[model samples]
Target: MSTGDGVDEVAEFAALLTELKERTDRSYGSLARRLGMNTSTLHRYCAGEAVPQDFAPVERLAEFSGATPEERLELHRRWLRAVAVRQAARPRTATTTEPEAAVAEAVLPEAAVARTAEPEAPPAEAGRADAAEAAGADSGGEVGSGGGPARRWYRRRRTALLAAVTCALLATLGTLSALPADRSPSASSPWPSSSADTSGSAPARTTAPAAPRPSPTASPNRSSSPSPTPGGDSPTPRTPEPSTSGGTAPGDATVPLTWTADSQAWALGCGHDYVVAQPPARVPPPPAAQDAGPWAAAQGAVHGRETVVEITVQGRSTTAVVLTALRVRVTGRTDPAPGNVYAMDQGCGGSISPRHFAVDLDRDRPIARPVAGNDTGTPIPAVRMPYRVSSTDPEVLLVTARTQGCDCSWYLELDWSSEGRTGTVRVDDHGRPFRTRSIAGLPRYMYDTSARRWTPYQ
Candidate 1:
């Protein structure tokens, strides 16, 4: 399999498929026969020329090759990534041409409109129109011998009407343009006034006082007190600043950073261990690591003793934002969740050298502590904040929060500053606090790869 920098998912998927087929010592024709597909079709899939719409064939092939559970899981992940890329790359058919065509017809001259409308004409009628035009041109601008005078008269009338329409349209546009920028056109005007507010409310001022500077030590949950203006009057209501090309305005309530949190991140080189309330028999077999989030939810599972959340953060604009700190706010604490613990993978070993932080949820004041690589034993220097990120440069932080004393419900607050504005962004599991329950002394189970069943962990 392709590894390390600049890996193409589609190519990696195809490489794995080719590797599996080669391990089985199977030829394209032989595998195709078994897969109920043509040799060429199978070859295309293995060569990365095509991705299968359904995963059934790929799964069957893996089983036929006697792939280990981990290998199968990796294969599935690669396939999913490849399929997503393919779907996103597919071209969307244009379905919005009619509105543009109407606009073109509204502004074009009559002759230009007629020419533009020709493509919509019936084939036979369009052919005849072209022939008539050719004949008129060849005959020195005459329609025919007897009808030349009548045609000339009709053409003159048509030209005069077109000129009058053009002049009237231009005058209307000029009148609209001459109107004051702040004034809305009357209701009787031809075009709807975009700036007019139909609601019978007080007109909003065009400008407002600048917002007060945010306190650096302000609590994330505490609302800031409004600052008084110099005239001792209540500060004018702040207007929302227009979004800048870099991102949302700094004073806006919305954070300028965009982030994705993966709650199923690998912990200490092992797959996620979820503490589900269901019994081993009632709960389904553990899914692959990538699908763990949904599976854990369906089983009503919380993270085991340690929950490693991988968060990828980047600024929405080109402006560099420095991530100052990550703070943990505990919402609740209780006894360990009562249930069985399900481990998604058996004993597995790997190295994770990403920039990571650790949180001790049992502590009175839990703070994210920068940590070195996990499982490798070799200690690397830990780089602590502040880290800079931009639209082009994203940073990934792996946060592992462990609780052995009590179950904890918590979320993270990321403090960031850019340009002279600082703000705090709350990060949680889709608006809900992340829950991690102490799995100590709980019944533990692991999927036995050989038997393909959940078994009690010794």
Candidate 2:
């Protein structure tokens, strides 16, 4: 593959895998027979001549080698990187034309064209011909034309434009490279988690027993050269510690909220992208709002950004964990309050379970609430909901609800202000309610508990 660096990342991983296999002292024939595949296929994969699209075999090999949890994680990360390199090397198009050819055909002068018209031309002459054609095109004159001074001027301008565009394209690519690449929750690991996630959280660290040191006889099949341990330099993602929660008054107690998810979820914002995972590490709570003038002070709500975890449950029991972060805020509260807000969505049966918690810093306790719809006499469970505390306005917490098993759902306006001062109101959902949006400019509507009718939302 013609990666500019000319490094065969796939081969590197293959070598690493080879080292691991040798440590197990299992011959290719024995391994292949166990995996029920051709021996050459395994060799090809180990030799870096080919990569396995499905990772089952690789995972199995890791298991056979008795790789430790960290080592296994490293192996997976390396495999992913190798796959990425291989895919990137694949040609995107069946055919491509040289840019010079197009320029030459479009702008070459007749004399120059005739001289370079041979079926084949030397590299040096071809280069000169391309330059001459580019010069001709810059003049803004027909291929056969002559605008001596004008052509020179145009050529200079054209060259400048090309240089500027090249710079711009390079800059854009660099920025894109800085962005976190998206990977499905199932692809990286089975679980999802976040510390303060808004979208899917990043992969969490896994622990496994370390493999025993191979015997001297087992070392014979391995190459003499040392193999680099994968992800050795990378920081291992740590499980977030559980946050503490419990108080009622501003300084009486501070409670930390507990967040859980049956599967992985995503949280994207604040320049950090992640997937939710479990046993999350604690993060700093949101800082209190700055004291500006009275108007500025009342302008936006103070928000907390922290890492959180997501747990994958099987019939009420957690099976795996992932980690991510989230941004939470409480409206109409800004005086360095000892609490933070957290929200979670979990898969419950055929629908979704929505929950949000407020951690009281002073008392160290959490206040949990399940946000549901009361459309029918009985509450209809929601499948998913999008919500957020207002930034500029300190009194609005916007949320929209949607049901999973059925088509029943609506919008809710929550007053996530101070304790003893918060409230919730059901409003017309504008039909499609799964989407999260602000109700600030929406048509005035509110649920009339007594009349049970939509009325102006004063």
Predicted model with the maximum TM-score: 1
Q: Write the per-residue lDDT of candidate 1 for residues 115-208, one digit (tens) a residue.
A: 4442344466556656776788887784544444444444565566556656665664554344222112234422223454547755332223
Per-residue alpha-carbon lDDT of candidate 2 for residues 146-172, written as tens digits (9 for 90 to 100): 544434554565566456645654664
TM-score to native of every candidate shown: 0.45, 0.22
RMSD of each: 20.6, 27.0
- The deviation in Å at residue 236 for candidate 1 is 12
lDDT of 2 at 105: 27
Off by over 4 Å in 2: 1-6, 93-458
